[model samples]
Target: MISTWRRRVAARRAAKKKSIEEDDNANMELTIPNHFRCPISLDLMKDPVTLSTGITYDRESIEKWIEAGNVTCPITKKILRSIEPIPNHAIRQIIQDWCVENRSYGVERIPTPRVPISSHEVKEVLTKIEDAIRRNDDESCLDFVSMIKSLSKESDRNKRCVVSNGAGRVLSAAFDALSKRDPIHEHVALHEEILSMLMISLSSPLDEETRTNLSTSESLHYIVRFLRFGSLSSRRNAVLALKVILSCNDQEVVEDLVKREGLLDALMKLIEEPICPTTTKASLLAMYYILKSSQSNPDKQATISKFLEMGLVQNLLEILVDSERSVCEKALGVLDGICSHREGRNKVSENVLTVPLMVKKMLRVSDLATELSVSILWKLGKDEENGEGTVAIEALQVGAFQKLLLLLQVGCSGTTKEKVTDLLKILNVHRQSVECIDSLDFKNLKRPF
Candidate 1:
């Protein structure tokens, strides 16, 4: 009987130990220390940083708060003396230890954060660059620009800091100064570096003053020079910078930019030789904006004639054949703009793959692409009837009628539906000539003949 009583007591002790273990496990799963969590995010701080107000928060959350134009601390409700947040190393270490200990519970340790560049530091670098440019010290100028470029590439915060601190003005000044030096070929490396720095610094949107400063004729002349003669990377940066400058939408600036001799040719070469997809896209966008701006100018036809003479239509048709969706869309957009003119229409109609390629791209790509393709076709066949024109005949031969019928059945925008209806009417005139349309079930088509 005593042994039985002892056994019962032992069993009670074992059960109590198991209960304690289960409670510990549950606690591990449910609890995170309140001190480890950010006041702003209410989540565990990955890069805990202390503000001037002595309150700690995650780096990203607090940076966003400061960037949103807030000057006061969220928790302390006091105005911040400084915007910089000091890293809370001790708390970060504690969090790391906790994460390591609770790793089996799916916790991962945060990486050590890279310190962001301060606006003061960016200004200091700009000062050095200005001084170097003043002294005409090519070596020092290259070093300083390279340093700024490295800092700009470090993080988005650094790029913003560089741009916000008037880097564009300083860099453009340097570029203008260096480009005027005697024996210009000697400073090619410096020019490339400055152009690269300018490209990186201006990656973000600019304020009015900075945009105006960059929009000058002197600045644009240097960029066009580089676009024609600089190395691959330099050429890329030059064109990208040109795009940003043109983005200001200044009419006088756009007119001056397009009239620059060899500018359109340089862009065409970039498209033809194809440095990289990004550079090609930038070139296309630059051309698109130039063409778009010309619509209001008296020199609109003159500009279109220049592009047509450069064989832009053929180049764009080749791009349409197999380019990626976004690229194909852009190429088609440019083509559509060009085709709006009579000469542009003749150039497109002359290309054999124009109709078939346009038809293939209609339903296979995105909605915007479909709209563009349909618009280009409508421009081509809208004037042609009874399959008399090459566009209509080729489109009929390539099953374009069936494609348009299918596009209408699947539904499209109001504009697209109207264009499709017009195209179907044009193609239906030749439907009796083509054998393919006889098999298509037009019974489901909502558009009447």
Candidate 2:
């Protein structure tokens, strides 16, 4: 008993010693100076590399030190890292300096040249607009609009007119100044005054040049705000503005419309309104451009998701089944473009409400809608190898399988049919799922759908 107890005590001591050694190994420390350049490389000691037996690090450690700025020699008190860190105050000072350098005659550096109308002249338009607005002379406002419209469009007869004659720049500068000038307490007064003028004339039937200028303006916020005016003719003109702006294929315009935060939601509301299908269609095409443009980034993916959630898929599904074949085809093409992304597919799958809503619409609408609905359903119901059993079974029972088979029989052609057919075959392996594809005569269904 004594011998056994002694052996157990010895083993415990040995285990404790081993643990202590490991702890020391894990906590080994190295000294580094606040500022010390590397002797060999002249860089700050990033991962200080020593030779294999000479305390030099391996190549990977050197690379890591380069990246992490953590290079240090184990024995030497040296910091071999060098990075230029900008101070917050210094950054502010630099920006202030830049702003000062760019300013001319009290105006900010807008990078655009002066309009044909000079500083004194902008005041002239403002003075006339102020008087006309105060007197409630709608005709005077309209006449001024016509004059601005004409000057905005004069053909560039001389080189000097090329930049200044563009109405978009002129209007943008005017609005920018107006929006920035008023105090918060006076915003409402300014808002009503501006709205009155904008509604009275800007929305009127515009010549091509005026429309072009309005659409091409850099101030998209103003564009969106004015477009939301109470008059129908004005709203129609806003749509026209979007059409022209979109045609320019200007990335800045596209970014302002789609990728930016506030603009997308506003545009979406415009599209959602039931007042004008033409406007709604134009909004959608603009959205398509946004998705296709280089301006698209991860941030706007959420906006796209919102669009899909806001019954975009359902709306397009309706168009896809329109009596006009061209409309239907175009709608399908758009749907295909949207669903091509994995993220897009996941969004549709998660939107449980969409499946039933789409089905109801497909029942009454065009053949193409029904066919595409089938395709979309199949895509939604697909499961990975380990897909949840209950979810998989529920999808099978929800009449999704039958829709796929019907599509196979009636709608899809050649290669697409074959893909659908193979998918059905995989799904049919389960007995409950097998019944959903009963429309397919098992023996005769060897070829693609």
Candidate 3:
């Protein structure tokens, strides 16, 4: 929304479209106080920043100014040797306070911006974490965790630094330490910190040392413990770590992790738990990996039964009703994976919401998500022209005919086109030209969905 406002301001500036009085009148609709405007853009400062000249500006505008070869302060015209822009938190606080005070007038309080840790500070903390890891100092781990997690929330520059400069190793070591024994009530908070920070620090992928630590069965056993009894944040991070570990694609390790006692149940519980969106995605992705792994194993029937017992089909269908595109894609992918089994397919057939949402997602989300949604449909709609052809009936009722037709008319592959054509044929035969599919125009299909 701020970007839209900024674009309007930029367009007006380039076209010289409005006079001072007109601009002021416009401000009544969305007035940033004059003091809040950046001198460069004449728009409000979202990230108030100051340079060596004691003049403050928005970070983005001043950076562009420097990149364009401006060698001095925009306000003072004083020459600058360096273009360092320090965050003007004091000014930002005033802006936020003003917005809060004016909240009844449709003013949006700007979010507290994430402060970047200096490279010097990052190096210093990395050193301390590594030293503490060597001594197995839980207290030092606690001392550094808040600062480390804050840094991780900063730019990708800091995240890459954290991964490379031994913080990943330290926290993975610390995570392993905390999992060694059952926790006392007094130490549970500290236990939560170690696991949460490790989750964030290793949020991407583990370095070699950390990866090796994760590969151990004993280590995974403890990580699974976080899912059972850990705090919300801690459990969220555990799923994040599990997603990464599975991505390593060590078939044997995947099998081992899947077999960990209570881990699958815990992961299934997370799927049912109505938590933050990210944690939900993490759990979904983790379940995707586990389901995919279980498919390749000989004990696949047992695994599918486990999923059925956990009532994952109903839980996942509920998740799909309201999730982001990525989460929707993962939920569909897991549904596809588990649908191969009779129990899983029966569970899916029992849910009223499943087929409608599958129809809803076709071309409504990204192509990847659409592909997975289509796969789930194929699993349900195939070779069932009888009363059990509920998937076909649901698809027709919920507009899958037009959606699939438009999907093919768009740039779907030969395989997808075949699936959609087959489903359409089944639905058309059942409907006898009187189907109640939603009205849609094939010409109106949006690109890059």
Best by lDDT: 1
Order of the predicted models by TM-score, top scorer first: 1, 3, 2
Q: Among these predicted structures, which one has the highest TM-score?
A: 1
Against the true structure, what is every candidate's RMSD? 6.1, 26.0, 11.8
lDDT of 1: 0.85
> Which runs in model 1 stand beyond 4 Å of their true positions?
1-32, 40-43, 68-82, 97-110, 203-206, 295-303, 385-387, 399-418, 435-449
The lowest-lDDT stretch of 10 consecutive residues in candidate 2 is 82-91
The predicted structure with the larger lDDT, 1 or 2, is 1
Ranking by lDDT: 1, 3, 2
Which residue pairs clash in candidate 3? 366-449
The TM-scores of all predictions, comma-separated, are 0.80, 0.41, 0.68
**lDDT tens digits, residue span 184-252, model 1:** 779889988988888877754667666765677776777898899878998999889888877777788
Q: Higher-TM-score candidate among 1 and 3?
A: 1
lDDT of each: 0.85, 0.48, 0.76
